[model samples]
Target: MSGFARSVVVGGSGAVGGMFAELLREAGSRTLVVDLVPPRERRDAFLCGDVTAPGPELAAALRDADLVLLAVHEEVALEAVAPVTRLLRRGALLADTLSVRTAMAAELAARAPGVQHVGLNPMFAPAAGMTGRPVAAVVTRDGPGVAALLRLVENGGGRPVRLSAEEHDRTVAATQALTHAAILSFGLALARLGVDAGTLKETAPPPHQVLLALLARVLGGSPEVYGDIQRSNPRAASARRALAEALGSFAEAAGDGPDPAEGLDGVFEELRRFMGPELTASQDHCQELFRTEHRTDHEGEKDR
Candidate 1:
């Protein structure tokens, strides 16, 4: 009585896609999944048909759906939207899991006015983030349908960052595209060198762990997916170039002595401006985490 009885997710087999199905099921929606590959357990039926098909199978699956999550990847997202448009019922909420929001939102607005279009970006890896993380939402309307989405995130233990389409894509370009490119570049080089990562880990300094943690994900996702994200966003290339320049400065400083944090003066200055002297709190926290660990390492060696 409290929740919607019917919901369906298309292409809900992959990580983020499967998450959509999982959340909806936990929300008490009797969900159906349409994908070539079967989704994890939320689905009532794992129908192996192209939802892009205009045939009765796609239509029938969508006809009774109160909500539909378009969870396909970006490359063929437009094509996925086209057929689903014909099948969604009047006032059905079409929550799309997508990165670029401009075209997707525009197409939905033009075709399905007031039909509850929401763009979603799950800001964590599926392996570890289901219990608690941030999920971004770009809403076309602020009503019951949007509330359903808000509830979906809350129930899934995710914080929601609501934004407009323009803001959504812009943030994704900087946060995801640019950062992913940076880590992936380093990770790919490391892979090519073919060093024993486990052996290297034993000698890796504190900063290397940070790089490993960041690159761990960038290397796991489809390389083609990363390539598309970096190329699709116009601002991504410039950002990556700027990051490259900054890294080059760090390299030069390491060999010759610009004293490590030389260029970081402005950064620290701005950060101190915001956090006052409390910015040094991280200095203590880092010392506790890394410095203490090293102290323990020395003790271990002495014991040996």
Candidate 2:
């Protein structure tokens, strides 16, 4: 039998929250969803409550939960933890789906020292589902509840990569924050150049098309979520600064000078050495993606 019989998911109306609610119900755990917005699925018991301004009804419900999972924004989770954790039983597990974990980990340690807790961050978009996707797990307090929840993630085809909260935040700063910044910078540059993206679509090379795709994906998604990713992670600023500095160096290397190509080559060689053996595999993967993108675009055109 699973340790979690009755699970509570805060912010169960959102994509990530709803995904967890569905997964828990499918796993036979009685799930109670609490959110301002009503979730689309009625499989789980729903409660309209605000965790930031939780009432007695919410506190009472938290007391009975075997596992309480927060799938809310980082700030909201931080605001809710103090009130929510106070109501939980000593053995109850508290878990969160936050992109940045260092603050949440600290909050849980301070407010819910006795309660079992973990932080889960799905690396992929919730709409994509969990299959073959990596979910970063930061285990704050180890217990049966934690194990069962991790097992639940694994059973749902999510790969759980255990990481310390600090490590998780730092790694995502480079991986998510820096990457998004670069793509956004590219989009900004295009705007500055007065280049119409639609006009370039047919003529753009694969690399440019890929950047356009990335830019579209980021711009198409919720600005609040992207903003949170950029703002919540403290180390993101450093990553952005590094990117800016690298671009500056590249610009200087490309400038009119004696042996500019030599300077560029030297920089490329250093980068190649830094990437090491992974460079070959990454290039191969990129080529595969380019082919897939090209094929997909053609198929879409044929449909029209």
Candidate 3:
């Protein structure tokens, strides 16, 4: 697809929104950013306005915009759909960078009527760029607009996975919610045991260190964003419950204590079977990762 002539990002001040704005600009689109707060870096291209209310600035931005990207929070994204739909130029493409798609997709379909819209969830952080990354594209209404937006993602080196809003939400519940819950649970366990960061760093094994690093990475992000992922996804609660159940089973197995090895072996075999062909690949990847880490450590020691 040919590049869009003009594009507007509704929440362009945000990380995800800003990243896409930059990507669009790099792709030769005249990109306009609309947000309540001006972007920290690119103040020049931003129009300060509330998208839900549809002010003159937003109307002007949408007047000639060939593409409109909603990169706001889930609730705000849903709210903006109706007003944004009203002002969009005929044949314009509307898309969102929301993590949870089911409710937002439904809201868009109900509120936007004939407007062409798509739901996009970049599986990695914007800072990571799109190279070799998986991006979920939910086609609420398929048209030239949807094709064009997906082409843009492909141009940026993203691997676009097509999914319905319902499918996307269900998959995210397991991939995102369950994983996050596990990490957060680990962090909570550490806190309960009163383990400080310095102590953990000094004493932890490689696997524990890796887990700690993951927990830190998650905690470093916005609480609101993580909260939304945990709270907004309808399947999140059940996923958490499943994790708790697994933990309880582990505890029960440990308490049985008369040769817990056999039980653990059974669990290990089950997981190995579940991983199938990926098990060897995952092990090799982890070994290489450890080698890299050790090399970095040795280099740092020499420098010191």
Each candidate's number of clashing pairs is 0, 0, 0
Q: What do the candidate models score in CA lDDT, each in turn?
A: 0.74, 0.87, 0.85
Candidate 1 regions exceeding 4 Å error are: 40-43, 187-200, 248-264, 270-304
**Mind giving the per-residue lDDT tens digits that candidate 1 earns over 1-304?**
2156788888888887787777777677887888887765644667787766756776887888888788887656667666776777777777888777887777766776657777888877777775668888899756677787788688778888898888887788779877887788888778899888897679777667658877885667787877888887666777788778877765665555456656556555666897777767865665565645566342222211
- Model 2 over residues 1-304: C-alpha lDDT tens digits? 3457888999898899999988998888888999997888677899999987778888788989998999987789999988888888878999999998888888877887888889999999999999999999999999988999999999999999999989999999998999999999999999999878778898887788888999999999888878888998999999999999999888778875554767688788999999999998987777677768776442232211
TM-score for all models, in order of appearance: 0.78, 0.91, 0.88
Collision pairs in model 3: none
Residue-wise C-alpha lDDT for candidate 3, range 1-304, written one tens digit per residue: 2368999988899889998888788888899999989899983388888888887767878878999999998778888888888888899999999888888767876887688888889999988888999999998888988898889888889989999888998999999999999999999999999768898899766677778889999999988878888998999999999999888777756666555656666677778999999998987777666656555452222211
Model 3 TM-score on a 0 to 1 scale: 0.88
The weakest ten consecutive residues by lDDT in model 1 span 295-304
Considering every candidate listed, which one attains the maximal TM-score?
A: 2
What's the ranking of the predictions by TM-score, best on top?
2, 3, 1
Output the number of the lDDT-best candidate: 2
- For candidate 3, the per-residue lDDT at 76 reads 85
| Selected candidate, larger TM-score, 2 vs 3 | 2
